[model samples]
Structure formats: structure tokens, C-alpha cells
Target: MVLNYLFRRKPEYRTRKLLCFSKEQMYEVVADIENYSSFLPFCTQSNIVDQNQSELKVKLEIGFPPIKEKYTSLVTMNKPNLILAKSCDGELFEYLETVWKFTSVPQGDPMTCIVDFSIKFKFKSNLYTHVASVFFGKLVKCLETAFINEAVRRYGRSSTCIFEMTSQD
Candidate 1:
């Protein structure tokens, strides 16, 4: 299905750079991240309709204030390397694509989960997309913090999972 009618046309998006963990380790993290809404606090509902060792179909309910938002997506787990997912068939965004990559360089005991991700999201031609992109930074921070906290919560401080952003400068 198409996420939005905008996709009736073609779409375009771009990714920036990345930091943390070796490529292998990053890939592991990406694979695990497919079920991220499962752990993210802001997410109210995450229904994994189907799954395998490396893929998922999730129905997600995310909190954003005015109203709760729901989106169902088919995510492919490009393990130990990349996890790319797009808007299911009929959804909000006209077009959407997110790519996540992991890279790691031995960092002593704990392995850094350096993640490089790009999101190309377009709306039905309006300011909504612009507004969302503007606030996306904060949302990403929330995700990062929650992700790190969850790592500690699950793996404990002794575990080797470092979720830190690398400097682009």
C-alpha cells in the first residue's frame, strides 16, 4: 500500500552521517530497533502483527499532544548493517523512508551503538511536514535517551551498549 497520496508521484530523501559502535554491532542494534516502539515510553501501543528473526509488521500508536497518532508499517531488518522501513500502504505521509546504519570501533569494554539514520518524509504539500521536521530533533533526543535508558534497564550498566552520537564536525 502507499503511505500517502503524495507517493502517487515519486519521492526523494537524503541521509547525513553517523557515529558509534562497529558496523557489525550497529547492525545488531538496528535489527533490535525494529521493535523499538516496544520499549519507547512515548509509544502507547506497538502491535507486532508479524515477525521473523529480522523483520516486523508493527502497528504503532505514538503520543504527540493534540491527538494520539497511529501508523502501521512494514519494516525490514537489514541485519548487522542496515534496517530500512517505509510507510505501509495507505498512511499519512505522502512518502516516507528511513535508513539506519551502524558502525563500531572497539571501544574497550562497552561497544558504542553508533547509528547513522536518514529520514525522508513528505506530507500532502503543506506546512505540516515542515513543522514536523523542525520538531523532529527533540523527538529524536527523546528516542535516544529512551533507547539508552532501555539499554541500561535491560543490559544493566555492566553491559556493552553505548548509545552516543558522533560529532559531524
Candidate 2:
């Protein structure tokens, strides 16, 4: 039990935010996996290995100081609504999944959307999991901010009101 507590399994992190961009705008930002390295935190490289109408296989390299890893993921796109990516490399991660959901804000401006983002992951090495757990929350927050900043850069601010949903860990 102590070991389990120390090296947690499949920790999931989630956050939702109301943004000043339309659902289509947000979806485009999230679905463009090949551009992740340009703006995403810790992403060193992003390359699309394969791509079709509804999906993409991408290889990503992420590094933070001494901890660097490269992995491939299968990204499934549901267009203007959902983008889900699952890790394909078992050597680095036992499992890793990221989900993004975009919906129009109810009773809000047509140019606004509610973005729900979640990531679930477990490292193959217990030591890595323990190390990553310490920085997981902050890392996820940074990632969220990166996307928001990118959206603002691309589309400009549609509204001044930005709502943050309570985070779920």
C-alpha cells in the first residue's frame, strides 16, 4: 500500500476554461498536432507520421532539463468538438491519453467556447512516475495556458471575459 501510494498509477488531470474563441477555432488549435512544438510547453519536436481525414499518428519529443522522452501517439479528431490522443509507445509510458472537448458556451457569445481538457498517464518506471507526479499539475496548467495564448495570437481576443472551471485532479 505504501509503495502504491508512493508510485501512483494512472494519475488523471483535468481542467476546463471558457475562452473567447469559437469551438471551431479552439478545435483547430488543438487538432494541429504538428505545430505543437512551436508553442506547447516542453515540446521539442512534433512530426506527423501519418495523417488521414479523421486521424493522425504523430511523434513528439518533450523534454524538461534532464528528463526527456520521445513518443508516438494516435490522434483521433472528431472535428470542432473532440480531439483524443493515445500514446503508442509502451517503452516510456504504460498508458497516456489526452482529451480535448470544445463546446459553445451556453447563453454566451457565439464566438466563445468552453474547453475541457484532460490527460491520464502512467510511466513504465515507478521512479519516473514519482518524479513526474510532483510537477504534473503545474505542467498541465502550463500546457493549458500555451494553448490559450496560441488561440489569442491566431484569432485575437473575441471577448474580454474568460472563465476558469475548477480543476479536477
C-alpha lDDT values of all predictions: 0.59, 0.87
lDDT of 1 by residue, 1-169 (tens): 4334423433333333333334664455445644666777667776778888777887777775776767777788766767787778556667667777655544543444456666666655455665555566676656655655555555455544444344442
RMSD of each: 6.5, 2.2
Task: List ranges where model 1 is wrong by over 4 Å.
Answer: 1-38, 106-110, 125-127, 158-169
Mark the 10 consecutive residues where model 2 has the least summed lDDT.
160-169
Model 2 quality (TM-score): 0.91
> In candidate 1, what residue range of length 10 has the lowest lDDT sum?
11-20
Error of 2 at 82 (Å): 0.5
True-structure lDDT of candidate 1: 0.59
Task: List, residue by residue over 139-162, the lDDT tens digit for candidate 2.
Answer: 888998898889888987755457
